[model samples]
Target: MLAPVTDHPDTAPLVDAVRQLRGAVAASSLPLPVEQVSAERTNRVELLNQLDDYVLPRLTSIDAPLLCVVGGSTGAGKSTLVNSLVGDVVSRSGVLRPTTRASVLIHNPDDTRWFADQRVLPGLARLTGAPTQQDDPGQLRLVASRNIPPGLALLDAPDIDSVVEANRDLARQLLAAADLWLFVTTATRYADAVPWGLLQQATERGTSVAVVLNRVPVDAMEEVRADLAGMLMQQGLGQSPVFAVLESRLSEQGLLPAAEVERMRSWLSSLAADSRARSIVIRRTLDGALDSLTGRASALAGAVTAQEMAAQALAQAAHEPYVRARGEIEEGISDGSLLRGEVLARWQEFVGTGEWFRQLDEGVSRVRDKIASVLRGRGRAAPVEDLGEALHTGVAALIASHGESAAMGAARNWRSLPGGSELLADDRSLAQVSPQFDERVQRLVREWQGDVLEMVRSEAGGRRTTARLLAFGINGIGVMLMLVVFSATGGMLAGAEIGVAGGSAIVAQRVLEAVFGDQAVRSLAAKARELLLRRVDEVLADERARYDQALGRVELDPGAAEQLDRAISQLKAVR
Candidate 1:
């Protein structure tokens, strides 16, 4: 039995700190598909189970009955031991491999209030009834019996090495929730790997544990007990009490003989009746659990740091390729590369050749009249519209090609990354440019062409150059301006293409210079170039956003690790 709650120091601050730590752990997501990430995730879940099922509840209710969870390997007779301890069949025991399906909590009727609520192991659903063979392992069955003492509760947990994964997980959770573990093992199976693994964990966490060496041959009791005791000493559990039960036939009611469990039963009864002794057991387990938190929480914090690094690396991998794509787009627009094929031929037809050049050197007024007369004679609408279409096609194709390349580059980089292949597998569309990309690029070029025309209209408004603009036609001048903007950076073209493309740019520039002076034409080209690049950037950014969305699915809160560290430090201080 525990003393009054006031016998212990106030733990409100410690509880609050641990709660904060739990929140941080819960918020630190590890969704990336990496090798170390899976193990770290398991550690995170186990830590959370310990805090929720035991630490927080025990801190708040220091006077709750001692919960001695009887847990061990498969076929270890844990259920039979629990029944024999209480001197009744509170839990079923049989030859079936897993006799205990749901965990059975047997408490004295007077202490039912403590076990009936959600204070401890709050995640499990509670069912109150006699223990049954059909119990669901997902729930906790509460059985109140006067045969058990008030200050102690025996919870029969599932086998530690149950073939069902859920049962194995539930067994681990129940053990973590215990104030004391009554670990049971048969003499024949005492050195099994699975039960010893859990014992090692108990040693690390400092949980109070006792061993039950059951079903030893009567003549071999001394040998097995001594060997088991020596093994416990080697594993740092020397102080844990060990009880030996010899192999014997069961009574008609399937209960062990009264003499077989007398010593262990008396020990539990005395431990429960003595408040000081009970407090020692509780405090020892509680302090050990608390002491283990700093290292465990720190480990979890480190895992969060790893997750953040992985996420950043993935985002960067997706970002670099788009950055290069933007640079390439800028180069294509400014290096006179876009003024090839259809655009160049269309420009020549729209501006004519020898006579148009001679006319440009004439007076501005004479040049304007000749340009208007020749355009009207040639029926200039078709030539102007044809040139506009050619420019649109060229710019659209330039942006579309680079956009596709950027998508492929980002996808390829992601496949080479740790978790990237899985993400790409989930969304195959990310491997290529978006379905609407070409459509957007076409609209972008058309909108930019419209913008250049508007600039022509705006710059020529209320100026003497308005006549030259009208003579050349606003559409024709806009197309000429597009040509100049394509090659605005000067000298990227080389060899024969440079001469043709370079001469075409010069003709477009002189025509614009004739209308809007040299400085104004240069200003218009600069502004137009800036607008086109800005639009291209917007298009490519949308493409980059696809990768951003994928990364967002696995993103962790960047501050989760620091918050966990602070919580652990505060908990240590309060303790």
Candidate 2:
């Protein structure tokens, strides 16, 4: 049994047939989720458009006749069954055994050309020799006759699970072409598992089916028949008809009895007895197919959703490191570490020898004192050293913690995702980050260094003495401006030198800043923004990588599906 699915992606537009209904299905648009709402509305339209490609083609290509395929294990009397039903030996009926090699599809002679070259279904064929009804008895030569009636073509397939692999492959191919299947088996070999597995193929694709019991002993007939029927019922194939064939001795003319042939003919008539039976078979086949397909559909959907969750989790996890790193960087910029170079540069320019001599001991002793304090404070804290190794440890920890835990984690997780995994959809795919992506992320974090250093450098641009010369800060600039205010008043104090400093002496001091009382506002604002940028960036990057990797992994390997689920769990916890 199989499912009859009429609507699916890549078919006709779902709402296209609305002209008959005097309206349409609004097939052009579907509402997208808020998260997916982009500047363009294309994906929404694509959801509907998929029907044109995935579904419509399968529907329109249904012009081929309904194939009634007869298949079974070797010596199930399938050939004899096919022969008896057709009222002719269209296929060889044999005792010398295992005769059929190529699958023979018997159809109307005119229809042979419709499918002769088909690789998938092979061909409806015609016999070359017309010698006799008994000619080439065991060769199982083809016999394409037009007597099968319209809308029906009969296929005789090779045995599944055959000793020859090619024959088994042929069986599989024939199964694909069968719109209806007649599974013939004997009472002795009824409970075999291979045929049931093969039947799953048809059941999953809406193929109509009938079961035939070709040989049954008189005493065990009822029990065997019931047992087989019970199995079918368990598999939800109860509606499929069961037909019986009794083996008989050949007549003197080596021909089957007329009554046995008539019984086989009667079965064919029942197949086409009325439209109701045809519809029943069709519906049952379609339903069975749907049942088999449901499991696969569920699995695929779970994989997709799980991938999404994993990406989100990895992103948020990455944020923690960046947040910590950003704080460290901002604090350094604010207090002094980032500005050390500029401070030294300006100190050489303005203070030169005068302030250098004064502050040299103070600064170096401050550094020495810090080291001594640490060495002395070991009972309370820990000893400190001025060596490069000592300096490197704290600095390195600040850099490594955020980059590795947040950024690298995100990259790895995303790289594991489908779109971001290996064999990416594009080079840009972020699914779990690879070694290459890790290198790229390091570059992004390093760029932040320039910003941090620049902020410190800008504040330290002029020497402290030069700043004192202008007297432009909160503590001293007012006094310098006041001196100019008094001296520049001129002539009122005759003999007083009123000469101001060079070109910059006339520059207006921060009278407004004094009034507003927020002298460090600009520097503070820049520092805050930079800090936030680092933190947010770290979080976003980690998640994006994890998401992409998980997605990519899903696409690349089925084994990654479980990993995808784990990633999804990580994603849900991210926020």
Per-residue alpha-carbon lDDT of model 2 for 240-299, expressed as tens digits? Answer: 788776667655534556676576556665655455655455445434433433343234
TM-score of 2: 0.49
For lDDT, the strongest prediction is 1
Output the lDDT of residue 289, model 1. Answer: 85
Computed on alpha carbons, the lDDT of every model, listed in order, comes to 0.86, 0.46
Tens-digit lDDT track of model 1 for 1-575: 22322343777777798898889878877788765888788888989999999998998888999999999988888888888888888788899777788899999999999978899999888988676666778899988999899899999999999988889999999999999999999989999999998999999988999999999998889999999999999999999999999998888767788898999999999889998999899888988888888898898898888878878888899989989988988888889988878887877677665455555556645655665677878988888898899988888888898899989999999999889999999899999999999999999999999899999999878586566677787888888888889885446667867767876777788778888889988999999999999999999999999998988877678899999888888877766
**lDDT at position 212, candidate 1:** 94
TM-score of each: 0.93, 0.49
> Relative to the unseen true structure, what is the C-alpha lDDT of residue 414 in candidate 2, on a scale of 0 to 100?
40
- Model 1 regions lying over 4 Å from their true place: 1-8, 132-134, 353-376, 465-467, 488-492
